[model samples]
Target: MRPRFITLEGVDGAGKSTHLGFIRATLLTLGIDACFTREPGGTRLGERLRELLLAVETEVSLETETLLMFAARQQHLAEVIRPALVAGRWVVSDRFTDATFAYQGGGRGVANARIAVLEDWVQQGLQPDLTLLFDVPTEVAAQRMAATRELDRFEREEGDFHRRVRAAYLARAADNPRFYVLDSTRSIADIQSDIAQRLAQLAEQP
Candidate 1:
C-alpha cells in the first residue's frame, strides 16, 4: 500500500505548524504509522539550503530564490519524502510547491509560466494526495506574525506582497480538488477537529 502524502500550507503565522503537531498526534492515536517533515529542511542538505534561503543577510533574486527552493525540495523528496512514502509510512509536510507559487510567483510577481516549468522539472510526477491550506486574511496573518519573534526575510515582505500570496493560495485551492482550505482565524481546537474530520473522510476513501 502506498502511503498517503499529506501536506499543510499557510502564510506565516497561520498556525500551520501547530496544526501539523495536532494532526500528527491524531494520526498516532488512530494507529497510523506516520512521519512528519518540512520542505527545504527535511535532510542535511535541505537544512543548509533552508538556512541560506531564510537568512536575513543572504540576498538573492526572485528567480534564484525559486530555483534554490526547488533544489532543496528535490533533495528533500529524494532523500526523505519519497522513500518514506514508498515504505508505506504516511508523510506529512509543512509546505510544498504551492509555497513557491505563493511566495515567488504571487508575492514577487514572477511569471507563472516560469514557476510552472520549474515545478514540473523538480517535482517530476510526485504530488501530495492531500493539501490542507490554512487560510487567513493578510492583516490578521501579519498581526499574528508580529506577535511572534522577529520576522524572517520572507515574513518581512510588504503587506501587499502577503496579500498577493494569500490570494494565490486561494486561487490554487479553488482549482484543485485535492486542496482543502480551512479558516485559520477559528479557534485551534475547532481547526483541529475539522482537520480530524477531513482525515477521517480521506481514510474512508477507497
Candidate 2:
C-alpha cells in the first residue's frame, strides 16, 4: 500500500502521548518509513504558536485561539506533513484538524461552519487516511489530569468542557469510516498490542 496519513486524537489525559511513541516505534520495527509529528508544534513557527496556545497566563479570544491553531496547522502541513507524504513516507500526527473541531467547536461553542471554512482554506481538503481515537471516560481523564503537575489552558477547563470534547470526538468517529476508537482505560501493554495489530492490518491492505 502507498504511504498513508495517520492521526491520533483524544481529549487531554487520554494517553495519546504514550501511544504515539509506541505507534512510531512499531512502524519502525515494521520497516515502514514514517514521519511522526504533532499538531501545533511540528515546525519552529508551530512550536512557538503551541506555547502561546497552551500558556495558562495568556488570555486569547475564542476566535483568536481557533485561528492561531489553524495558522500553526497550515505551517505544519506546508513544512512537514505534506512533504513527508509526498516523499512516500507515512505521516503519523499526534493530532490534526479533528482536534480543532472538538476543542473549539464542541468545548468552546464555536460554530462548526466557521471551523469548516477555515479547514477548507488551510487544509485544502487534505485529511488523514486513518485516525486512532483514544477513548477514555471523562471522569477517568479528570483523575489523570489531576495527577499531573501542571495543567495547560485547555486542561484547566471544567468537567463539562471535557465532556463535550469527548462527545464531539466520538460523534466524529461514528460518522467516519477511517476512525478506529481504542479504549484508553485498558492496560498500556494491551492497548499497544491492539494498536500494533491495527497497524499490521493497515500494512496488509492493498
Candidate 3:
C-alpha cells in the first residue's frame, strides 16, 4: 500500500501548525504510521536555507528566494519525505509548493512561467495526495499573526500582497480536485473535527 502524502497550507497565523498535532494524534489512533515535517527545515540543509529565507537582516531578490526555496525542497524530498512515503509511512507537511506559488508568484508579482519552471524542475511532477488549505480573510490572518510572533520577511508584506496570495490559493483550489479548502476562522476543536472527518472520507475513497 502506498502511503498518503498530505500537506496543510495557509497564510501565516491560519493555525496550520496547531492542527498538525491534532491530525497526527488522530492518525495514530487509527494505527497509521505517520510522520510530521515542515518545508525549508526538514533536513539540515533545508534548515540553513530556512534561516536565510526568514532572516530579517538578509536581503534576497524574488528569484533568489524562489530558487532557494526549491533548493531546500529538493533536499527535504530526497532526505526525508520520499523515503518515508515509499516505506508506507504517512507524511504530513505544514506547507509545500503551494506556499511558494502564493508568496513568491502571487504576492511578489513573479511571473507564473518562472514559478512553474522551478516547481517542475524541483518537484519532478510530485504532488501531495491531499492538500488542506486553511482559508481566512487577509485581515483576520494578519491580526492573528501580529498577536503572536514577530513578523517574518514574508509576513511583513502589505495587505494587498496577502490578498493577492489568498486569491491565488482560491484559484489553485478551484483547479485542483485534490485540494480541500476549509474555513480556518473556526475554533481549533472544530477545525480538528473537520480534518478528521475529511481524512476518514479520503480513507474510504476508491
Candidate 4:
C-alpha cells in the first residue's frame, strides 16, 4: 500500500495531545511504519517559526501571521513530510492545513478563498488521507487549558474566538469525507475506543 497521510486537528485544549500517544502505539501494533510530527515545527526552520508564532510577546499582523504559517509549512513539507512519505513511511501530523483554515480564516477573519490559494500553491494536491478532529465546547477547552500548561498566544484568545475556530473545523469535516469528528467531551476510554476503530479501518485501506 502507498503510505497514508493522517492529521489530527482541533481547537486548543481539545485533547489532541492527550490522545497522540495512543494513536502512535496503535499504529505501531498494526505494523505501520509511521512518521509522526507536528505542524509549524517539523523542520528546523519551521520550529523557529513556531516559537515566533506561539510567543505571546511577539507581534504580527494577521496577514503576516498567515503567510509565516504557510512559509513554515512549505519548509516542513519539503524537508520532512514529503520525504518521509516517499520513503514508505505513513505520515501523521498533529496539525496541518485545516488548522490555518480554523485559526487564521475562521478566528482571525482571513477569507477561506485566500487560504485556499496558498494551500493549492504550497501543497499542490497533497492532503491528509484521514483527519481526526477532536471537537469540544469552548468552555470545556478553556477549563482543560487552565488546569494544564501555560497558554500560548493563540490559546490566550477569548471564548468566542475558539467557538469560531471550532465551527470552521466542523465546516471542513462536513464537506470532506476524510475528516472524522470526535466528540471530546466524552471520557477518554470512549474516545479512544472510537479512534481505535477508525484507525483499524484506515489500516485496512490501500
Candidate 5:
C-alpha cells in the first residue's frame, strides 16, 4: 500500500485523543507502517511554539496567532510529516490545518481567505488522504473535558466559542470528500470499530 496521510480532528473533549492509541495499534496490527504525530509539537521548534500558544497567560493578536500556527506547521511538514510519508510510513496527525480554520477562522473570527493563503503557502498541494473528524455536542464535549483534566487556554473558552469551532469543523467536513465524521458520543468500542474499518480500507487502497 502507498503511504497515506491521515489527520484526526475534533473540538476539545470530543474524545479524539482517547482513540489515538487504538488507531496506531490497529494499523500496526494490520502490518501497515504508521507514524503518529501531532501538529504544533511534532518538531522541536514547533513544540516551543506550542508551549507559548497553550499557556493560559499568554496573549497574542489573532493574526499573529494564526501565522504562528502555520509557521509551526511548516516546520512540522519538513521535519516530520513529509519525511514519514516519503519513507513509506502512513502518517497520522492529531490535528492539521483544519484546526486552524476552526479555531482561528470560526472561533476567533479570522477570515477564511487569510487562512487559505497561509495554507497554500505552507502546504503547497499536500493534503491528508483521510481525515477522521470525531464530532460531539459542545455541551457533551465540555463536560467530558472537565471530567478528564484541567482545561488549557483553548479548552477554557466559553461555550459559544466552542460551538463555532464545532460548526466550523462540520462545515469543513461537509465540503470535503476525504473527511469521515465520527459521532464520538458512541461507546469507545463502537468508535474504534469504525476507525479500524477506515484504516483497513486505506491499507487496501491501490
Candidate 6:
C-alpha cells in the first residue's frame, strides 16, 4: 500500500479524539505503518503557536490567526508530515486545512478566496488522501464540550458560530471526493465498525 495522508476533522467534542486510537490500530492491522499527529502543534514552532492560538486570554485578528495557522502548517509539513510520508509511514492528522476553511472562513468570516491563496502557497499540491469528517448536531457537540477541562478561544464561540462552522465543513465535504462524513450521534461501536469497513475498502484500492 502506498503511504497516504489521512485527516480526521469535526467540530470540537464531536468525538474524533476518542476514535483516533481505534483508527490507528485498524490501520496497523491492515499492515500500514501509521503515525498520528495534530495540527497547530505537530512541530516545535507549531506547538508554541498552538498555545498562543488556543489561549482564551489571547485576542487575534482573523488575518493574523489565518496567517499564523499557515505558518505553523508550513513548519509541520516540512518538519513532521512530509518526512513521515517519505519514510513510508501513513500520516493521520487530527485536523488540517479544512479546519481553516471552517474556523477562519466560516466562524470568523474570513474570505474563502484569501484562505485558498494561502493554501496554494503553503501546501502547494499536498492534500490528504482521505478525510474522516465526524458530524454531530450543534447541541450535542456543545453538551459534550461543556464537560471538557477548559474552553479554548474557538470553543468559547456562540451557537451561531458553531452552526456556521458545521455548514462550512459539510459544504467542503460535498465538494471533495476524499471526505467521509460520519454521523457522530451513532454509538461509538457502530461508528468504528463503519470506519473499519471504509478502511477495508481503502486497503483494497490500488
- Per-residue error for 198 in candidate 4, Å, reads 0.7
The positional error of residue 31 in candidate 4, measured at the CA in angstroms, is: 0.5
Over the stretch 57-143, how does candidate 2's per-residue lDDT look in tens digits? Answer: 989999999999999999999999989988899999999999999999999999999999999999898999899999999899989
TM-score of each: 0.97, 0.97, 0.96, 0.98, 0.98, 0.98
The lDDT of model 1 is 0.88
Lowest lDDT 10-mer window, candidate 2? 17-26
Q: Output the lDDT of residue 32, model 6.
A: 87
The pairs that clash in candidate 2 are: none
Worst 10 residues of 3 by lDDT: 197-206
Per-candidate Cα lDDT values, in order, are: 0.88, 0.93, 0.88, 0.95, 0.94, 0.93
Better model by TM-score, 2 or 4? Answer: 4
Residues 129-190 of candidate 6 have per-residue lDDT tens digits of 99999999889999999987578988999999999999999999999999999999999999
List clashing residue pairs in candidate 6.
none
Model 5 scores a C-alpha lDDT of 0.94
Top-lDDT structure, candidate number: 4
Q: What is the lDDT of residue 53 in candidate 2?
A: 95
